[model samples]
Target: MSNSPTLGYLIPQFPGQTHIFFWREILALERMGINVALFSTRPPPPGLISHVWSDEAMKRTEYLGNMDPRRAAKATLGVSPALWAKDVLREGRVLAKDLAIASAAAQKLKESCAARGIQHVHAHSCARSALVALLAQQLGGPTYSLTLHGPLSDYGPGQRLKWRHAKFATVITEKLRKELPELLGEDQPEKIFVQPMGVDVNALIRDVPYHPHQSPQQLRIFACGRLNIVKGHQDLMAAIRLLRDKGIDVRLDIAGEDDDGGSGYRKELENRITELDLQDHVALLGAISAEEVRRYLLSAHVFTLASWHEPLGVAYMEAMSCEVPTIGTNAGGVPELIRDGIDGLLVEPKSPDALANAIMLLARNPKDAQRLGQAGRTRIIERFNCEKGAELIAREALDLRVSEEI
Candidate 1:
């Protein structure tokens, strides 16, 4: 363990309700004899920090948002004027205020890595965190890499500069990996690996065997994701309505809050629920801890999310790990995770009737439901678990190239 390389792990927000995958990967890295030094731009808003391990994670993470002005000034002045001006142009699409903050964060990161003797930093996002890592490396900090969780557009501008400078990059889906060559052209990183995010299969198992709903009455369905229009919570609600009209007594519990605690898009969903007269059938449980999500998955007969687009759904992986028959839309990288009519089911995005029919099919056939549930857990164990992802990261981070492909 003493000889293991100490790697800087950077995240935009260290510990939030939806960041369990990051925590899992960190743990996996540590278990494999890699020392992980946690770094973050800032803490998440108080309401968004719902994980039980959040307090411990926050304690380990060094926040760089609040830097001493004198130190920040010195670090900013230390960079070559020509390089600074070039970066300013490289980041034309980014806000001026955000660039200033990223500069300060880079300074803090440079000093921290020097003091800690970290040789490499890997950012879990390609957003401003990647920019900060880029700046830090420019300031003579540790060499850095990046992981792309979603589309390049979601990460804002300077894609060419970030990818061109990073030691390597990993994407959560092959589809995204394939897009990089066309987007970055000749500016692509030297190493770009396709590695999907994964769940902790050992922790997400069911205590008892799963059985399908015996009766149509009180058939419970569960969904977990942010309350955003892109996540398609409204479409799922409409599907619940469609199921209700067919004389099937069903209940849906959505377990996530809007971006601003509950003030933002939750109001829109509450109004829509009222408009559809689904007050009794659907409940918004707000942001929940991972254990609570597991409990919900264990109790529910079906787990589904109607996201209009998802990069790669960790939520779906978690449900499948819990042996709950899962359903997802054929959007983004979800098809790579779920093979239709095999491990689980996939429907077209934004179709409420399609969602309703899939739910009904599982509700009617208990035997097929059980088969898919068992197969889903097996799929997670064999391929999509977190350990495999961590292995890929370790190999790439340490430059331990093997002749055979991973």
Candidate 2:
């Protein structure tokens, strides 16, 4: 530790499954000799911290949402009442709860960061995490920034407040970049920069034994993600039905955890498979390890996810990194990653025919599949490499530190 300050990460979930990019960025920044402290508002959801990397993060993180009575009292007394009330007013009703308590606990967060000599804070999500940043700033803490991750639909009310004093707001994709002005007002153009969630393309794809062209007698199609309606798993199942109807002898492997123990949408997927009489053809391999996911990707003939609202899918990136000829909808940030008919294939959202056609085309033509898959790996390496994204972010953070000097 020199005379400089550490960076603080204010996040809702520290070791979340969908937040692997955050960990990668943190690790990369650490490897670059930057000190980062994790301040999570909530502990991770059940089963989200299974990975060894996540366990390491959990050890370093402090959960503000779980403060003890004496600590809470000290935190409460540390906040200036006027400042807390001001933040509550600025945050309004939607974020008032998050802002109020976190603002009151601002001293606790500040004390933790201050102990590490952290000067600037970067939050992961715009809503809860950014609100914490805003409130912490109000309490005379770190100068804070935020990343706008998804569509600003649920975050409209809160984001505008966050942007008013945020050091900068990084968009997770170009799609969100275009909407920054519309979502955060027309004046926020200068505050926004597109930064997609990155994957370690080289590490993920390197030297994985490739699945040789499978016989038409057995085609294994793989999709891994949260089993939910928004991911369009049902539509994916419909595509499987199309492939089976044509007697393509395709087998689908769906690896993911249900939101509510196979009760809601996961049940729907299982019922749909049963309804199509394709139960034997489709296997729902629930929630495998990250290594297992990599294995599945490397071994599969095709990787497909027909999501309707993918802001950007790390799953798609991972699949492409493994050089599995991938299929994704023209949804959200997917178009930015996949150049349809060039690197991989893109189908219309919820269009089983297009997805099925893409699957069949790749299945019958192994040479084309290999060609597209290799292109995808090259594209990921050049464009979406995790180290590159982390370097850009670290540059921006250092730039902000110099400019803000707080």
Candidate 3:
């Protein structure tokens, strides 16, 4: 334990999903007495060993600040360019922003690691954070690694840059690992590792025996994710409306932030809910903390996420750990976790009718819902606990360093 290596964690921003994953990994490493220091463009909260740079650096490195002008230019370039040009134009805006953030974050990370004697740097995502970690490694000579979460929209132009520069990369699902080599080339395949995003399964698993809601008169259905176009919340809302039209008395609670790529999708969702007269039946509880989210799961009969394309649904795992029946779109890594109709239901992505039908099927059949929830909880305990995930990542981080040295 005393001989374990020290690591520096780098990110463009902290206190979000990336922060959660990085912090959990840090805690896991710390359990073996490995030390971690975090460096970010945005300041981290107290209790995390964080290094914050000046406000000027933040302004220059922010994604929004760097993206707008480039995105506007790309939009003006029109869509008729060559396929490569079109792909570059489409992904260029994000790449520009990530590169800018990484450039600035790298300088800060270099200074921090040099001062702290950190051995390796691991970034939470493969975009800006990975760029920062890579550049910082070049500056400080510490080996760098990255963890890739889903939604490739964030990687854009800088994806290749980060992949080539990182000592190794960890992805949350095998689906992502399969896609990486194609994007980064076969030569870099050895640098990619598949590790699922994990939760504290023991803490989250239902301690007591399964108990159905005493009153079966009212059914509670839950869905969560950033409320946006890709999340298919609009489809879920439409499905809920269809169920209501058919005289199915059900309640839905949707939790998450409303800012999804600035499309005003959240407002549209609210308007549709109003138009359908579902104000009383649907509740929009925006962006609750993870602990609060657990409480919401405990209170609900079923948990659902209808995202059109999810890389790996961590919220689904969290809900499953809480013994709640789950349903998700059959896109991305969702099918990897859910054994359709066994552990939970898997409906066609972006189909409101399919989502509605699935919800109604579970709502009417409480016994099946209970069985699914129990099965899901059991599955999560066996595979996706934080302790197991951390062990794997920590081992990989150390291995990456050793391999680089060799």
TM-scores, all models, native as reference: 0.95, 0.89, 0.81
lDDT of 2: 0.76
Ordering by lDDT = 1, 2, 3
Model 2 per-residue lDDT tens digits across residues 1-406: 3644478887787676566767777877666667778888887666555465777788888877754566445555655666445545865675555655555456667777667777788888777667667766766678887787788875645556678778777877887787666655743625567777778765687475565466656898999888888898888889889888887888889888675534557778888889988988998887666777887887798999999989888888888888999999998888988999899999999788989988988988888998888888888888777776566656665663323333
The runs of at least 3 residues in candidate 3 whose Cα sits more than 4 Å from the true structure, single-residue gaps closed, are 1-4, 17-19, 43-101, 151-153, 186-189, 207-209, 212-216, 260-264, 399-406
Specify the highest-TM-score model's number.
Answer: 1
Give the clash total for candidate 1.
0
- Local distance difference test, per candidate? 0.88, 0.76, 0.68
Worst 10 contiguous positions by lDDT, candidate 2:
397-406
Enumerate residue pairs that collide in model 2.
Answer: none
lDDT of 1 by residue, 1-406 (tens): 6676788999997787789999999998887778889999889888788888999999999998786787667667876756545645756635344556688889889999999888789999888898789888888998999999999989976677778889999899999988888889888888888888899998999998787988845899999998899889999999999998999999999998888988999999999999999999999999899999999999999999999999989999999999999999999999999989999999999999999999999999999899999999998998889988778877777764333332
lDDT of 1: 0.88
lDDT of 3 by residue, 1-406 (tens): 4355677666655554223444555566666566666566564323221123223323333232123444334332422233124334656766555544445445555655667677787777666566566666655457788777885556656566566656777788888777765676643625576778777775576655555543446768888777778888878888888888887777889877654332356678888889888999998776555566767788887789889888888888888989898988899899988889789899999898998888878777778888999999888888777777566656677653322322
Stretches off by above 4 angstroms in model 1 are: 1-3, 81-97, 400-406
TM-score of 3: 0.81
